[model samples]
Target: MASPRRRAAASPALAAFGRQFRRYRERAGLSQTRVAQRTGKTASFVSQIESGKKRCRREFVEIMDPELRAGGVLLGLYDDLNGDGQMGFPTWFDWPEIEIEADLLVTWQHTVVPGLLQIDGYARTFLSTDEAVLARLARQEILNRDVPAPTSLIALLSEHVLHHFVGSQKIMREQLEHVLAMSEVPHVTVQVVVNEDGMPAGNGGSFVLASMKDRSEVAYLETAVRGLTTDDPQDLAEIAHTLDKLRRNALPVGMSRSLIRKVMEEKWT
Candidate 1:
């Protein structure tokens, strides 16, 4: 028999909640079939909920909380997912909540350094306002989480990012050094696509793909004035394929670091 297929999540928040629910269920030592039986649903339905392919209703949470001994933990997470917490974010973007729950992050940037890897001065140059700068810095918390669930980052940068001179010669130098330092982290990988590489994939703009612990993926696209986050399976698949192509075409990690060091010595000095 063929193995069952896995599905991507419908949204980042839903995927996060599903992960929490699954963890609690496992802690309670109950199977999806048993959970379904208790809630008047099928094992398939429970599977979908845990995979984030199906929504978990309030009624389901009510039934699950006591059974799983979650002590209202699941309900609290559900409320957070449903709340209006996007007021301070940029328009049409809901990535912050999703980013918090992602176990893997893949980013492709053609212009500036990816946000998570950017230094304070470099980030301030692009963010424009104090609040915006703080907000951008706030997102970096995921990279340094104290918990066991560390977020792994794979950042792909175009060769131009090192030479672009974001703030000043000094700031750029500091920023590049910061990138080098971040790459030393066990969970972070940095690669560069040299100008000669000639537009491998995702060359039009920048995007980030976040993978939840459950293996469901979501994607975010950003431009000069607009940003969008999507959980559509087809969109996520296409983005993933493009990212894979970019990864294959980019310089390997060691060589990329060498390239950065060479640029710093030649240009920044």
Candidate 2:
């Protein structure tokens, strides 16, 4: 028999389950706070479960079933995790089915731009020498996709993010030019959160809010520790509120583009 599928698979399934469960919960009008109270779990525990950073216990699923009332789906996922080894998403994380059909992606970059939209040089600078190769190979695959959706990306970059040059000044200059070039893509909207604005973004950490099919939204957050994925309505709502604030504090699109060009000129010279 095929070796039992690894726990890496379980993690993603559980993660997906949390996402869908939250959607259904919102549809059924149950708040996350309410779910936490009913399940006797902390809100952070609930968040971690939804984000797939923590393994959700089977008993908790059963307890949450009628409370969230998902017709037994989330409980079923918990049962599925019983036999596993090496839990967590593998490197080859396929886009969640929902994210593949996203209508818009609003993202903030405190240190660097998101990989999906990064230039090869920029991506390399952000990653370690070991990770850079793998990331480049992945980008090549993404670019090769035949029916890649007309992805709409609203990218916000911090002024400090640009100034903190990762690679050599030469590479950094090229990367800035690359960013300016990406701005010309019809579906890309680029903005810079200048330091003078004095707004604190990325304080809660880096996150991406993607608008998916049927108006579904997914949030992705990353820290020094790990990557987090969630489609929970409550979590998404909170993240969206934070992102909206960042956007308001960010420089206007034209100004950001000009700033990028100016940076390129200054550095390239």
RMSD of 2: 13.6
Q: List the residue pairs that clash in candidate 1.
A: none
Put down candidate 2 lDDT per residue, 102-209, tens digits, no spaces: 667788888876676666676776567857657554643332355775667788888766777666788778778777887887778889986555557667888877
lDDT tens readout by residue for model 1, 40-126: 999999988886678877899999999999998888777666556421222323577678888899899988899998878999998
Worst 10 residues of 1 by lDDT: 85-94
Score each candidate by Cα lDDT: 0.80, 0.67
Could you tell me the lDDT of residue 171 within candidate 2? 73
Candidate 1 colliding pairs, count: 0
